[model samples]
Target: MIEQFLTSYFVKNGEHLEVPPKYISDTIKQYTVAKQTARTYRNVSFLKVGQLTKTKPSQELINYKFTKNAKRKLTEDFSTIQSWIKEGWIIEEIVFAQDGRTAKAIHYRIGPSLKYYFDAQNEQQTQRLENYVLQLQKSADIQPIKELLQAVQQLNEFVAMPIEKLAHTTKLTPHWSIEKRLRFLHFSIGFFQLANEGVLFDFKEIGATLFDKIGGSKAFDRDQKEFIEELERVFSVQTIDCGLISLGKITPVFFTGELMGHLAIIDKVLFMH
Candidate 1:
């Protein structure tokens, strides 16, 4: 579901998925599915209308692939050439520059092979199908994953707010990488869990940062208290004895916790150079 969540995050409210079909393929591989479902597709569908007229004269010579994937070898489907011939005549087997670089590809024009592939009977339907791919590319994205990590760093730099305050002040978007952000949120959740038990205030009787004083400076209202109660149920964390806790786990022990969370969060998303 993380993959679906990430894919939907990019698409926003669109019907078609993004282009570079490989991204979708890669994302799908992350989830549980039959291996064949992920691996069983023609690598690339390179479509180009061949310019030379002497061969087919009336036919358009094009690669068997309607989509081009740079990583896929043009050779894997060379056997498919026979399959193509089953439906259409092979005008030529040649190597030509695709995107202006020399690459081996089979080019054939409109014929029985392509007829079923792209129904000539319905021209408008074919055009819409092409437009759909173009729109899909604009939909799914990877930038937000990067953006979230940067945003969290900025928030931590300034102030230490409660969970609700943090969410109110910062934007945390969910996607496949959402678990990355959730890890950061979870670290604070442990502290709030401690606070609910009054362990923070109890330890502070000796000495501690002001933030751990819960109802001290940034006090918790009834609604916020209810939130932590829910968070407890959601994460299913248990309360531990404050006497058994380390000083670093309690402060305003939050700075150390936040720091740890941030470092762990960075690793989960894009790796830091």
Candidate 2:
């Protein structure tokens, strides 16, 4: 009967034996049997070797050592082991030994929760997750222009003031105001009443006068006509399509989309007056 019980309960495929024959024999001897029962207890020894045959022979049993802190949190029993296994603990094997008159077994294997707990506690993994979340939050804070435009449909006072101030504070030359400059010429030359009403100007006379005024013929060059044309386009009272005039001559010449009028000092005084 002892042999059958050992065979049924003590050994199975993939199961680890927990307790040596000496311990099993001692346990049976303590059962307060009759003096004649010593032989029967001794007979149970043969059953132990057969029980060992049922267990996985190649796999060795493993024992785990835990620090005091870890041991406090990992206090466990048979039910705890069963629960852990049910929750995915991988039971590699079990260790069996005999201590004095008692048979003892200690489960030894890696549990899935143990791995998960350590992974969660790892500093590197925690820092990585924190950095990822911080980056996501920073990205979320950046407002897309279209989305910003959608918010607060009408420009608020706070938004408008800075733009207005910027426009006012920006420095610009006195010459840039087109409204303050004249765009039409309606002057009479003595009694002749020459309207000379366009961007027309005599480049030869202007260049000669400029050289005489500045006392340098080198100052007057072939590009005088082109420069005058550009000056007219930039600061004169007439458009480019307007014909040219040779200041007191009657030929009424037209600039071939090239010559322009210059903004003279007299013109500036006239504008100011």
Query: In model 1, what lDDT does residue 127 have?
Result: 61
Candidate 2 on 1-273: residue-level lDDT in tens? 333333343344433323333333322211111111333321111121211111221121113432112222234665554444443332222232322233343333333334334445555655754454343333233222442332222222212233224224222123322211111100101001111222344434433432345533233343444444443443332322333344333354454665555645673342211
**Across residues 52-127, which tens digit of lDDT does each residue of candidate 1 receive?**
1122212232444332211223342554544333334232222334232344564443332343334443466546
For candidate 2, the TM-score is: 0.18
Cα misplacement distance, residue 246 of candidate 2 (Å): 86
Shift of residue 168 alpha carbon in model 1, Å: 16
Which candidate has the highest TM-score of all?
Answer: 1
Structural similarity to truth (TM-score) of each candidate: 0.20, 0.18
* Candidate 2: segments with Cα more than 4 A from true spot: 1-77, 90-92, 96-105, 120-124, 128-273
Candidate 2: residue pairs that collide? 18-96, 19-96, 19-97, 200-244, 200-245, 229-260
Worst 10 residues of 2 by lDDT: 183-192
